[model samples]
Target: MMELGPKPRRRTPTVWVGPVPIGSDHPVVVQSMTNTDTADAEATAAQVIELARAGSEVVRITVNREEAAAAVPRIVERVRAAGYATPLVGDFHYNGHVLLTRYPECARALDKYRINPGNVGARQKDRNFAQIIEVALKYEKPVRIGVNWGSLDQDLLTELMDANARRPDPRSAREVLLEAMVESALRSARFAEELGMPHDRIILSAKVSEVQDLIAVYRTLAARCDYPLHLGLTEAGMGMKGIVASTAGLAVLLQEGIGDTIRISLTPTPGGDRAEEVRVAQQILQSLGLRTFLPQVSSCPGCGRTTSTFFQEMARDVQAYIQRRLPEWRRRYPGVETLKVAVMGCVVNGPGESRHADIGISLPGTFEEPTAPVFIDGEKYTTLRGDDIVPRFLQILEDYVARRFGRDGDGKRAAAPAGREAAAPTRRGEEDAGGVAAGSAARSEAGRPGRPAAGTPAGSAGGRAAGT
Candidate 1:
C-alpha cells in the first residue's frame, strides 16, 4: 500500500462578529463597558484605555442620546492618542437610527454598534433596523443586536402568552420568551440581508437574567442561525452566585461550540473598580483554556483525606500573590498562559486532571507516596515534605511564569509561544447523542471523549452531551 499523508486538518471558529472571530480556532477576546459619562470625551477615553489595559479587547459605550454620539469624535481621537487600539461599540436603545444617521463620524469611529430591537422603535422594527443598516453600510461597521428577556417586545410577549395558554407546560414562559428573542433576531437579520448587509456584519445576543433561560434561548438561536452569537447572562446577581451561575451557563454553551463571545456581568463591590467584571470574563476563559489574559492556577477541591485549612488559605493567598506579582512575571516571561501552575489538595485525579499543566504540586494524600512528589512538565522533579511545600509550590509557579512571559522592565506583553497545530476530528462518537450523523465531527475538547452533556447536548458536530 502507498504511504498516506496525515488526515487533512481544518479548524473553524466558533463565532464571528463581522470579520472578527472568537472562540475555538480564534483567540478568546475580552470586552468591557465604559463607566465614564458618554458625553465627556476625555473621561470616557481614559476609562476606555483603562479597560483595555485590564484586557478588554472590545469596549462598549452607551449612546442613549445624540450628545453621547457627538462625544464619539473626541472619544475616538483620545483613544487613538492613548495608543490603546481597542474597538468601540455604540449602544443604541430608543433612537439608534437617528444617531446612526446624524453622527456618521461617531458611527465610523465605533467598530461595532449595538441595537436593542425591542426598544428600537414602536412599530415595524424592521424599518428601524433598515435605517441603522444604512449607517453601518456608510461606515462599513458591524452591529450587535442585544435582546434582553425583560425587554421583549410587548406585542411578541402577548402573542407568545396566548400560545402558552394552550401549551400549558412548565417551560412555556421560557419557550415563549426564547421564541421572541430568536424571532426578533431572525427578523432583524432578515432585514439586514434584504438591504445587502453581509452576514459578517451582524452579531446577536439573547441575554436573560436566569442562567437556564439564557442557555435555552441561546441554544435555540444557535441551532437556527449561523450568525455570530454573543453569550451573557445579564444582571446575573453578585458575588459568588454570579460567578457560579455565569460560569455554569457559559461552560455548557462553550463546550458545545455555541458561544462566540462571552461576558460575565458582575455587580461591582462597594468602592471597588467596576473593571472586576471584565477581569472575571478573562479569568473564566483562561481557566477553561479558552483565553489567555492571565495565568492558569489549578487547585483541587478540598476533601476529607489530607484536608487542611492551610491548603484552603494557600489557594486564595496564592491567587492574590500571582495577581500582585504578575507584572514582574510578565517582565520575566513573555507568554505566561502557556505555563500552568497546579495546587492540589490531594492526589486522587489531581495529577491527571492537571497532567498537561506545566507545573503542579500534588499534596500528600491517598494518591501520593510519602514525601509527596512535585511535578514539572509531566514528571516528578522533587519530593516535598514538612511545611516547606506551600511556599515551594508558589515559588515554582513564579519561576515557571517568569520563564514564559518574561521579566522585562515595566512588564510588557512578550511574544506568544509557538502555535499549537490542531486538526479537526473525523466523526462524532456520542453514546446517546441524537441526530448525529456517521461522519460528523466530534467535540474532542472535553475529557468525556465525545460524550454529550446531560439535559441538552446537540452541537454543530450534530450531537449533544446531555445535562449541563
Candidate 2:
C-alpha cells in the first residue's frame, strides 16, 4: 500500500524573522500582504495588526516610493505599540536600492526585504540587486528573492529560449518558461549569497498565475535549492476563482512538503475585508493538517430528514460562540484551538459522528424524538430538549472546555467545579423539564489522552478527543 500524508518537509537552513523562524524544522508559516497604502502609516499599521491577530505570522507592505519608505519605521513602531511582534517585510521594486540607502531607519526597522529580481532595473540590474543584498547584510535582515511570472527577467528568458532552440529535441515553450522561473530564483539566490547574505538569511519564491504552471515551477524550484521557498499562485483573480486557484496550487505542493511559508494572493472586492486572505491561508494549512489556529466545527449540510431550521441555527450559533470565546480560551486554555465539534441535524449519522468529536451535539430528525444528545469523549453526556436545547448544549460545551482545558492562577490543573462529577448514564424519559437529563454522565478529566498539562500549549495534533 502507498504511504499517505504530507511528505516529510524538505530540510533547509533556518532563517529567523525577528522572533519567528522558517525552515523544515519549524511549522509551515502563514503570511499575508496588506493592500493598504504603505505611505499611510496609520492605515497600514492597523491592517498589519488585524492580519497578525487573524494569524498571519509575517506581513508585507509595499515600499515603492520615498513616502512609503519613510513611513516604514512609523508603521513598524505602531504595530509594535499594538503589542504584535509579527515580522514585517518591505516589498521593493526599481528604486529599492536608493530608498534603502536614503532611509536608514526604514531598512533597520523592517524585519526582511522582498525584492523582485526582474524589476530592479535593466541596465543596473546586478548593481541594484547587490545594493539591496548589501543593506540586508548590514542590518542582518533576511531577503526574499521573489520572482513573479509577470515580472520575470526578460534577458534571462531570452537567453534560455535561445539556448533551447539549439537543442535537437527542444522542450515545449511552457516547459522552457517553467525552467526559466526556477532558474531566475536559484540564480538570484546564489548571487545574494555571493553578495554576502548567509544561506540561512535568504528565502526564494517563483510565482505564476495558472495552477499547473505554479505547481510545475515550485516543484522544479524546490528540487534545485533548499532555501525555504515561499509559495503562492500570483494574480489568482478575485472571489471564489482566486480562492480555488490558490488553494489548488498551494495544496498540491504543500502535500508534497515543498513550501516553508505561504500567502494567498486574493484580489478582494472593493470594500471587502482585507483579512479574508489571512483566513483563507489559515484554512488551507489547517485542512492539510499542517497547523491549527482556531477551533474547527464539523457540520453536515442539511438534508430532507432534517426539515426544520433549528439544527442550522444551532450550528451557526455554535460556530459564532467558539469564535467569540477563542481569544479568552486561547489564553486560559492553552490547547483549545485544537477542539473539534460536530453539529449533526439528523439521527442517521448524528450520534456516530458526534461520538467522534471532542464535544458534539446530535439533533433530532423529522418524526424522531425531539431530544438532542450531547456527547463528550465518545459517550452520551446529556440530553437537551425543546426551545432550551441550543442554550443548554452551549452551556455544556462551555463547561467541558473549561473543565478539560482551563489552567489555574498558579499554572496548575484546574479541578472540576464542585458537583461537576460525571453523572451516571441516563435512560429514556428521565430528562427534566428544564432541559437536561440528570443521569447522563460526562467523561472524567483524569487520564485523558491529549489533555494539555498546566503550562504547555497543545501540540498540533492534541486537544481532540480519541476516535475522532
Candidate 3:
C-alpha cells in the first residue's frame, strides 16, 4: 500500500460489510448516509440505490424511531431486488437499544449497526449499550461504535474535566473533548468485546465538528487500538465550506493512513443531488491516488495568452463525455478507469501535459498557429485544425480506448499496455508513421533555451511557442 505521509497505517483487525472488506490491507471504503426520512421506505431505498450507483460502497440511513426501524427490512429488500448488493447500515441513536429489541426483524435485516455512544442514556449507559451489542451478536452483524464530540457521553466528559481541574496545568476544553471522544469510542468497543463481540466485528469512529479536533482524536484512537476507524468531520455545514473543511480533515488523517472507512457528512443544499457527497468522497480518493472510479482529465485554467475559450470549452466537454461513458466502459473495460487524458489551453504547457497522458491535445492560442496537436503516449500523432478539432480529437480518444482496452473472445478486457516504456515514441512512430507529424520534437528534447519543459511545473508553460 502507498503511504501518503510519515505515519504508517495503524494495522487493524479486518471486518467485512457484506462482501466488502474493511481494515487491514483493504482499499479504504467510501460510505455516505441518506438524507431521506427513513420511515419512507421507498424514498430511502431510492436514495440508497442512487448512492450505490454513485460509488458509495456502503449506504447508511437513520433509524431513530420504531417506524424507521420497522422499515429496514423493506428498504433492504427494495435495494437488493434492484440488483445492488451494497451493504445497508442503520444509524441509531438514543432509542436504538429499545428499537433493536422490540423489532427483531430490523436487527436481522441490517448488515451493520451504527450506535452513538453518547446518546444511549446517562444512567443506564452500560445496559443500553450492551443491549445493542447483544442484538448485533444475535444478528451476527458488525457494529460501528460512533462517538460524536457534540453528543459526547456527559458522564465521561465530566469525569475527564474533573480530573483535569485537579491537575497543576489543566488541558484546554478542546483537548479534554478530544480525549473524551477517543475514550468513549475505545471504551465502547471494549464493552462490546466483553459482551462476546469479537475485535474484528467492531469498527470505531470519533467525530468532531472542528477539523483539528477530528484529526487529533482519530490519531489518538489509532495509536490506542486496532479497531477499524471510520473517519468523518461531524455536522460539517452546507456548501463549499463544508466540502473544503471535510476534505481537509479527512485528507489529513487519510494521508497518515489512519482511517479504514470514511464518510463525508455534507449538509446538501435544498433539492440538490444527494449523490454529490459520494462524488466528493470519490474525488478525494482519486486525487490521493488511493482509488480510481473514472478516467481522469487534466485540464489547464484559461489565461491571458489564451484569447479564445475553445480549450476550456473542449476540456469541459471531454470531461462530461468521459463521465457519460464511464458506466459502459466499466462494464466493458475493467481497467479503463486508470486512463489519463489531458486537454490543455495553450501551446506553452500543452504538449508536455499531453505527452504525460494516455491521450492528449494541445490547442492553439492567441496569435500562434491555428492547428491543434493530438498526442498519444508522449508522441505527437497528428495536428487537428478548424471545426474538426473537437470531433476528431474525440474520435482519436475512442480509438485509443478500443486499442488499449478492447474485449477478448471471452468478453474480458485485454491487458493494459505494459508501461511508459511500452508506450515509447519509437514504437508508436513505427506503428503509425503516416499519422506522426514529421519533425515533431520528443517531449524530453522539446524544451527551448532558457525555458522549462512544457507542463513541467504544470500550467506554467502556457504561453510559450508551440512544440518548443
* Top candidate by TM-score: 2
Candidate 1, residues 1-468, lDDT tens digits: the string is: 763432221223333332234444444456678766899888898787666556565678988888899999899787676554456789898898988898888878887889888888888677887899888887777788888877877887787778778774644566777888888888777778789887767777888888788778877888788777788887877888888888888877766667666777877677667667777876676666554555667787777776556656766766766666554444344555345667777767666654566776666664446554667777665666666565665655554555444544333222222222222211332211112111111222333333333212123233121100
Ten residues in a row with the worst lDDT in model 2? 432-441
Indicate whether candidate 1 or candidate 2 has the larger TM-score.
2
- The worst-scoring run of ten residues by lDDT in candidate 3 lies at 431-440
Query: RMSD in angstroms, all models?
Result: 13.1, 9.7, 13.6
Tens-digit lDDT track for model 3 on 353-425? 9999988999998888899888888888888777867766776776577667767534232232221121111
Error of 1 at 207 (Å): 1.5
Candidate 2 — what's its lDDT? 0.79
What RMSD value applies to candidate 3? 13.6
Task: Answer with 1 or 3, whichever has the higher TM-score.
Answer: 3
Q: How far off is residue 241 in model 3, in Å? A: 0.9
lDDT of 3 at 322: 69
> Which residue pairs clash in candidate 3?
348-461, 349-461, 446-468
Q: What is the C-alpha lDDT of each candidate?
A: 0.65, 0.79, 0.77
Residue lDDT tens for model 2, 50-98 = 7766667788999999999999999988877755666789999999999
TM-score of 3: 0.86
